[model samples]
Target: MNAQIAPPPAAAGWQAVIGLEIHAQLSTASKLFSGAPTAYGAEPNTQASLVDIALPGTLPVPNRAAIRKAIQFGLAIGAPIAPHSVFARKNYFYPDLPKGYQISQYELPVVGPGKLKVRVDDGRTIEVEIQRAHLEEDAGKSVHDAFHAETGIDLNRAGTPLLEIVSAPVMHSAAEAVAYMRTVHTLVRWLGICDGNMQEGSFRCDCNVSVRRSGTEQLGTRTEIKNVNSFRFVEKAIEYEIERQIRALENGEAIVQETRLYDPTRHQTRSMRSKESADDYRYFPDPDLPPLAIGAAEIERERSALPELPQARRERYIAVLGLPEADADQLCSDRATADYFEAVLAGVPGQAKLCANWVLGEVAAALNENAVEIAAAPVDAAALAQLLSRLREGVISGKIAKDVFAAMWAGEGSADVIIEARGLKQISDTGALATAIDAVLAEYAGQVADYRKGNDKLLQFFVGQVMKRTRGQANPQQLNELLKQKLAG
Candidate 1:
């Protein structure tokens, strides 16, 4: 189901203010500040390095690849890339954080203010403001159920590089928040900076939600829903949080400013801990790592290397390709799908609409049924293009093409081979169509007589008979014309 926001029943006189803190793990070979490998599903602490574990006499050095990725993201969003940014130690204590303080950007972020345009489920576009995006190292996992009454710590992710994207509290509904998140998800993947895999913990969201009386300038006390991974869960968590805050205010109870976790099984947000202010974290510049610096040339280099972004591709698909808005949107949702679409178009030029129909219709259904991505589809784009070319040139009817496509997906030979082997070519020959039409008219003589006597509806029956006799391989336009001429006499 598509993620959508439905207003709560008690939300008549109240409004929701939502902002999201998205953590996207950077795609790199090693950790942010050490030489430790950052691969997932390793044997726990085997991947943790001495620097990641905060061993004595160890110092941290920032990964250049991670920094470049952060800059690439900044440029992609049209944000100002800070020439100089400082890393501060965020003082916090957790079981997964081996270091007492997490090294992160506080006052000076790598990326400044930006905005992203999001399309909601209702087809309306809304622009969400980005406050800042800073670089940070991820903490490890605290496994609770791995043991009977004890916990296990996995340090494989402790030092994984992360880009924490913070957005302004400009969203008013769960739907908008989700739309904004999905847009970022697509952008990061398109930029080749982040994998955007939510299940693997490469991408996650912390939703800051609050409710206030409508038409008020003052914002309400907000609670943070931390680390909701999936889009549907994000929407559900925000909806529940919004309704919870509104009910509390209506009942004369003040909403608490705290951090909460979404329990998917229960569909509720429960308090985890009291939210800490910046003062509580005691942010200060790290002494070990010097202030990072970026040059203008580096930013421009990243900018020039970026592929066409999703929004631009979507617009081009609509304006240049003449595709419908919805079709273009779906096509550009993923870079792979969009690339495949263009490949098909390259094979069969001037047939953008037809190419889109086959890709979005037959190709999509085949991928879904076989549980594979477009990259791993049984039928390649060139093969599908070949099939479409045959259909375009009247070698086969649309229905017959579907049959050939199914056969191709099942490891059958090329479309030409299948069509030839099965005698599936459309009967567009004037001689053959006329002979078939005469046979149908002779067999249904009463209907043909009634049709000439002004019962025009019988023409369809005659056409159906001709199609049935031809095994649905008749060219529709040719059959209609020849059948009409035969009935006239």
Candidate 2:
């Protein structure tokens, strides 16, 4: 899809123009401009180095890994990778900002002009235009109420690296905005540049929401919703903001441009502070670091290392594996589930549909019931494949296979072992099956006579009787054929 800015659907004659700025923390070992470690959950100031603390005469040196990741992300999104990008100092004052100013990109960012395809729940696909993705250093976190009458500072994240992705205000609805954000989230994680953990503050979004009258070209004043960590919250915050703006307009009140916070509990947005423009930040090139230079060779290396993205993988599953759209979507929802699905396919090649059914059906239910992920599944792919093999070979009926699967999930040995111990194998031996069928025919003589007299539906009755007489051990297909011949005679 071409990179075009399209507005979302209008609500009550007002169009919502939504844009998102997402900060994806780079999965790096050290800080962006210092050698300080970048591990989370570390005690306050323990991981901070002298440079991170901004000691006198401390110089800022760029981390190579973080920059490379930014380039990789740009390549993944088909963005232009700038040969020269400047690191600008954004001046701002906050308790968490130990450096008094943030080191970020402004005029010349590393990545420029990319687009992502967002597929909403209603099957409408829209291309969200990405303005730029710039590399920046994160600030420290403020611990509220850590000490009575005093807050605490944790500099462990002070110098962490981030790639701030800015998008154009084109989405017209909250759902479209969320679809765009989730597509970006999946892209970053699939590229292996970020963990994409919303709970860990690894990936967060800042939403810019505005509303205008239908068929109006002029844009409306936009409010910035800051630090929304989850996709559901992103949708909710935008929906509430749209409603708030419409009410203000209807009541003859002006929509103010400011920053707001989303209260997930109350499902509303509250004003945090007035929005700051670029000029407010006093952005200027940093004197401590020179402009970053990237050669064609470096960009090529990053591009060559890129894996197949999620969208492409989903298509491959549908086309190559012959999986249904819903099944492909569910398997490709996350990397863990996709990897597990492939592992099962590896064990049972040429049975993609069966593998998909089991993975999506019984396996998923078991995992949810046990409160675990696929990685911790009690019955691994190998064990499940073994059970499927038995079912295929007619060693067990479908009903007995479910019993064996249950036993396997409970930590019983392999499927074959469980089948042997329980004697639950299907009765496929013609001699034994014939004897069982004969007894069923003798017991249901009336039904048998009716079947020969053209009551063909009675075939089902005889099959059921035969299966019950054998305690569900008879191979259903074999029982059907034998019963048909006996009833005809």
Candidate 3:
């Protein structure tokens, strides 16, 4: 339902209504129709096929794997999987489309009606409802460069499978639209369904923006803004468009419903052309391919195989591990890293809190500095588990553990091996700690007397002296207790 956009009781109030359409290229082996390799970076024209070239009599055959992938995505978003779907001709004139009309899903789309919960790493989740997700073949791109007078067509990307996810007009601001887009990107990539590389055009989005009164129910005439390449661009485009619409209304000018292109350098949206309705294309069924049908059994099978979604895993981490909300969110952002963290915690006797602290801090830092993915980390869960076990047992001080981790990353050894090689064992021996404690007491008799007089601050000084004498190898837990006991006298 579209909200009314009349001027509010006040003259200056405005609300931004945004909806997003994201085009995500499906990850598959071959092109949708052409048998030519659907691979990236194959010297120009090497992967082109007869169908790609639009040679007469070359028929299009539906790729079963691509269809299955489309269905998988639909189920992932809880969308309605159409039992029977058809391909339609989206007729247009462009150098990239050799047939002058691109085959796409218009009337009977493969999927419909889904929603995604956008968590912007903020405390709130913005739930953007989905309008539909249609499976379509991507058109090849045309290149017009300053170096060449003639334009060139690259059909290497022709027939690439794409799922266009359209959202309901549930977003109220540019920031909300961006958050929804980011969440969708994260979900698809984490599921290994889409690479989500926007720079290479693996994923892209277009957002529809309009302004309305804060309390009015009527919708304003909306403008469709396209060519939003990055998150920052999406925000800037919406901001400019909203202001433009609001100004037009205030000036007694009608809001024009047109397609606009966002210029990042100028931070503005310029009119590209008037928007076209469905009839403009005259869409019809493709004679080459038969009607597509998805069965109930197949849907059931795919649903059962679906991985644990991000929100579920995040909640589980917070609930089961008692970790802070922010910490849990960070750890669960990556699927494999979350899995590895759970594995290391399984059946461990220590506090899970400490494990999370180490993982989020030192472990994550090392991985980032080395330019490595978590799955490719040199230290695995088993190794980390072994390492944390030592810290819990007071076998090494916290300072020594940092040295041990450095050594482990440098190919030194496991936790035990490094502890031995560096002679970094914790000095937890009560007798040794007591002798050192006695020396500190003698050196600072006044502080000891003050401690006996109920001063707790002097206790830290003793702990520091113990650590200094032991070269940071003193077990802090044991030293703490011993120092407290000695200071009591």
Better of 1 and 3 by TM-score: 1
Model 3 segments more than 4 A misplaced: 1-11, 120-122, 276-279, 347-350, 443-455
**Which runs of model 1 end up more than 4 angstroms from their true locations?**
1-10, 276-279
- Assess each prediction's global lDDT (C-alpha) against the native: 0.91, 0.89, 0.81
Cα deviation at 164, candidate 1, in Å, is 0.7
Q: Model 2: clashing residue pairs?
A: 8-172
- Against the true structure, whose TM-score is highest? 1
Expressed as tens digits, the lDDT of each residue in 308-390 for candidate 3 is 88878888777877788888878777777787777778635446787788788888999999998878878887888888888
All candidates in order of TM-score, best leading: 1, 3, 2
lDDT of 1 by residue, 1-489 (tens): 132444423368888999999999999999999999988888889999999989999999999999999998888788999999999999988889999889999999999999888888776777789989999999988999879888898888998999999999988899889999999999998888899999998999999999888879899999999999999999999999999998889899999899999999989999998765523998999999889999999888988998999999999988898999889988998998999999998989989999899989999999998899998888888998999999999999998999999999999899999999999999999999888888888888888788989998887898899999999989988999888887886
Model 2: per-residue Cα lDDT at residue 321: 96
- Evaluated at residue 9, the lDDT of candidate 1 is 30
Going through the candidates in the order shown, the clash numbers are 0, 1, 7
